[model samples]
Target: MASRAAAVALCCLLVLAGCADSPVPTDGADSPSATATPGSSTAIDAPPAATPKPDAVEVEVIDIVDGDTIDVRFPNGSKDTVRLLGVDTPEVHAENDPTEFPGVPDTDAGRNCLREWGERASQYAEDELAGETVTLSFDENEPRRGYYGRLLAYVHVDGDSFNYGLITKGLARRYDSSNFQYRERYGTAEGIARGTGTGLWGACATESPRTATETPIPAADGGPPLWVSEIHADAAGDDRENLNGEYVTFANAGEETLDLSGWTVSDEADHTYTFPEGTEIPPNGTLTLHTGSGEDGDGHLYWGEGSPVWNNGGDTVIVRNGSGETVIEREYGG
Candidate 1:
């Protein structure tokens, strides 16, 4: 009897061990902490949604002036007289304007030729600008809206620029200001146009002398002559490395030479650089002032024997002629 009881006890222990080894199911639910479900598809967290970018303003061209200036009709129904930021076109007199072609002959033939060239440039500009949309950017020096309340903008048409196009076609020359950001590209385009003898080159050829009597003249006392119209910072060559050593330039607007000996350059820092006794700028010329030592170029002025005015950061520059007259002033923020 004892042997039979012992055998039954061993059999019960074996059954209990088998039940413990088997996995038991709870109420029809999965484990709370489990990442994957048995026989179910693998789950993945959705990636965070990307942020959207802001929309850009749209611009359209309505009319063209030579290859540079344009009439752009803004979304607000106002007409904008848009000057191509980096280009200067040959002078074209308005209809019946007595003083239109200064320094150029007013003969019927010369006038007709000038008109034809202007028209041709305008035609080319129209072809490029018509029905085209562009992105417009502005320089800090330019008013958001011009004095006339017209929208002022530097246009980027297609991937290339219409401003550069003018220079490439010789319809325009580079017109840089201290605030212009696209200096290098404009300079290159102007150089190319000069070499090619395109629109303005052929139109204003020395062979055909045009009269200057009809050329427009600014008010005599008008704040500083137009020759000192635009100022620029020389950012080329080694000057690019030193910010403070940057130089400021003056451009002559008229077709004659300008004397700048009595001119003075100053900044907010109270630093003043007076022109040496023999400074002169030719027609449509450029005068540069650098920090370091160097001979003044044919159309440039070097300041500070060998050091630049501003170092490697940023500053403001003001140019004035004798008599405490202001020629040009610009606050640079590089």
Candidate 2:
């Protein structure tokens, strides 16, 4: 009886020892603090990690420099000039390179047609990209740099090719280099625009060039001979610093080239400035008169001093031709 009792006591002690040796079941929350193992961590309930963004850089359009070129600001706060791949538009501004396309003839009539079409192309690009964010993609197989060190890229606006869109609209032609990857696609788009006679292809096809002797110039087709098209009296940034801000745009609505050498633009107080000698306003062309001073160039002239000639409150602008005849008068602000 004593041995049997001893054996039972030993069995009970062994069972209790085994229970203590085994790990205590824990819900982690109810357990005492413990050091985490090297390869393991506590399960965490958290939102899934965010997917990484693509490598393509995003930029804001500073300006639609033309149909093919754009000025952009990058994420790193750097500025660059980007030339679109596979497309070219008519030159709106003069080019430094003598080999550039759609060369305008020296004749006034030929220049007038070029100016009109160039303006349309510029306007079309501005309407689509001005102040918008776009993505710039480069060909991995081709040289990234283009003529003049401008970055050659495919500009995408909301995943649609901006270059391709322009070609389809007939505002641009397929101007592809051997390095261009989208040459075939762009060529096809140009064909569609040409076949349908879209935009410039159809609109300007039958238009005739005008000479200085041409009567009833483009703007006078049914409208006034000349008119004030745009006025920025308040300026875009600061009129105090950027005198060009307070300016007025005059468009020639007539078909004849007007020699504006002695023409005058005046304020209500006779603050008059005369167009310099050799100033010529072409048919359907525009001239901008800046209230601030700078060297004059094509399409723009300076008043040669600063201190706000145009009043933001109310102002009247009178434009007189060389003969002292008031051709256009405009009022604003009041």
Q: Each candidate's lDDT (Cα)?
A: 0.50, 0.61
Instruction: Work out how many backbone clashes candidate 2 has.
Output: 5
Candidate 2 lowest-lDDT run of ten: 43-52
Return the lDDT, model 2, position 192: 37
* Top of the candidates by lDDT: 2
TM-score: model 1 vs. ground truth? 0.40
Model 2 root mean square deviation, Cα atoms? 27.1
How does model 2 fare in lDDT?
0.61
lDDT of 1: 0.50
Residue 8 error for model 2, in Å?
67
